[model samples]
Target: MIRAVLFDLDDTLLRLNLTAFIARYVAGASRLLASVARTTPVALGVPYVRAFLAMDAQDREDSLTNEQLFNKTMLEACGIPLDDPVIADLMTYYEERIVPGFSSGVVAARPVPGAREAIEAVHDAGLICALATNPTFSLACDRARMGWAGVDEKDFALVSTYSNSTRCKPSTRYYQEFANQLGVRLEECLMVGNDAVRDIVRDGCGLRTAYVGHGRPRGAVWRGPMERLARELPDLVARLDEQDA
Candidate 1:
């Protein structure tokens, strides 16, 4: 019976052009870290990008926290040995500059039209709300983006982050952990996101799911834009409840 609704943040609640955000952030990050390195930002960009990719790859397998894995890989990519003082500086740049910069300055984000109303619809239906964002970034990063998207953090019962989650999106374990955290079965929760493959791990995770756009549900739970979701969710929730009963 639709006890919870987990919403994806990027491209769903907020419109963040991933390519654009990445370019801006990489530039900002290089400059931020270059103070410690006596080299060109472009050279730093190469390994910075590589390390981030490595972290994403590691996120799926190891139980290491995202910060732990990122620290190890980034230090290795930079040719800095563990326990080097420079590792501290890199981490400082990440925590103090990189992630926060995305929200206010490094990248521009826009709220998805009607997302707030859709969230409200979910609430009115007496379902719990959660942010099932990919666990690649810290909670602060997701919270900042959520603020721009007009989603109040206070409203969510669970918000996934790198420190809290072991797996990233597209992995069934990610959704499984999310539902486990909420203490609900997959069928009792509905996941809504823009990315078809990453958000709805239906065949893998067996969770009810929804997509946003012209894309049909296509073995998903629901499909429509935010405006339509705002209108459809309450009725849909009622129908699901009846079916479950």
Candidate 2:
């Protein structure tokens, strides 16, 4: 009955060159970490990339939260001891200070034109609203980007982050866990995102998708930009409810 609407953050709610941003972010982080450790950024950069890839692999049976996996892998790859204080310091500094500072120099990171209004439409329909961005970053990192997207953290019922989520997106398990957290069935949620393959569920996952990307994908029931979504979402939600009834 469309009890919840899950929104993807990057490229969907926030318009930015994601690849470029990742590169810049990794470079900045490497430099910052190297300065503290008295090592070369190049040394830190290699391990950071490896750790990120390990997190993003989306293993269905893994029990660890993405944050735990990231930390474990990052430290192991860097050959640092498990009890090192640097990990804690790095996490704190990166989340609290470094990420927020990126907003100024990164001109490409801007809120999608109608993203906020689209969120409001979900609220107006009385549906649970969730930020279902890939759970590869901390809540602080997600919140910082959400601020750049002009959305308030207070508005969402669920905000997926590395510490909270066990699986990455494009895996049905991620959506399954999200719905379970919201106390709803998968069929009751509609995923709204720009990536066709990553956001859309297949193989009888039961969730429907609304693609907001450039071209229509096979599984998406609706296709349009965020502006159109803002205008039409209530009606669409109503339609889904009626169909369910």
Candidate 3:
């Protein structure tokens, strides 16, 4: 039986224009780092962008956490030492101030239709509900985005963040890690998300996927919008569990 429901944050539970958010986020970060690094935002953005993209290259067996890898790559690219005190200040300012600021004005992050109800459905079925967003940012940033999604951190049993996760999404190890956190077999979890590549898994991780993206993608055992999921998830979960059994 499926004991947990792992929901992706950005385009799944949250109606986020991830591309736009990333662009704005980069701009904001560049502006902030420019002042500290004594360089123009345009000049600093090059290395910043490089470091950001480096986070996407997941290792099957990585020693460094996503945050650690980001810090290492960023410091190397920027010629900043690992022990630099400014590093702490930069991270603190970014997560506490800059990331929270992204919620309003241009960043348009909001809840997906019926997202809250879908979460409620998971709980009603007595399943473990986790916010399985890609762990590229701090937990504070995740919580800030959660506010935009009209969800609370308290709602989830596990909220994946850069501090806690070793890998990024689309990696089967990332999926397996969350299952491990819930103390359940990977096969006992249903990953619900809108990304065709990140949400669906064909590899032998034993995790199942229910895609809520634009089209029916390959490897998804189920497909529907959040509204349908809200109404039907309990029954659907039971059916999937029974089928597997």
Error of 3 at 212 (Å): 0.8
Assess every candidate by TM-score: 0.84, 0.93, 0.93
Writing each residue's lDDT as its tens digit, candidate 1 over 1-245 gives 77999999888888877677767767866776665666667777777676567656724567776656665776777754424677565755575555655655435688999899988888887889999988876676676678778887898999998777766777777788889999998888888898877877756445777788556757676778888988999887778779779
Sliding window of 10 residues with minimal summed lDDT for model 1 = 80-89
TM-score of 1: 0.84
> lDDT (CA) for every model shown?
0.76, 0.84, 0.83
List residue ranges in candidate 2 displaced over 4 A: 81-86, 104-107
Taking all chains together, the TM-score of candidate 3 against the true structure is 0.93
lDDT of 2 by residue, 1-245 (tens): 88899999999999877777777777877777677667888997778787788778955467888888877887787764323676566766776787766765554789998999999999888899999999988788888889889997888999999888888878888889888998999999999999988898787988998889998798898899999999999888888889889
Residue 117 CA displacement from its true place in model 1, Å: 0.9
Error of 2 at 205 (Å): 1.1
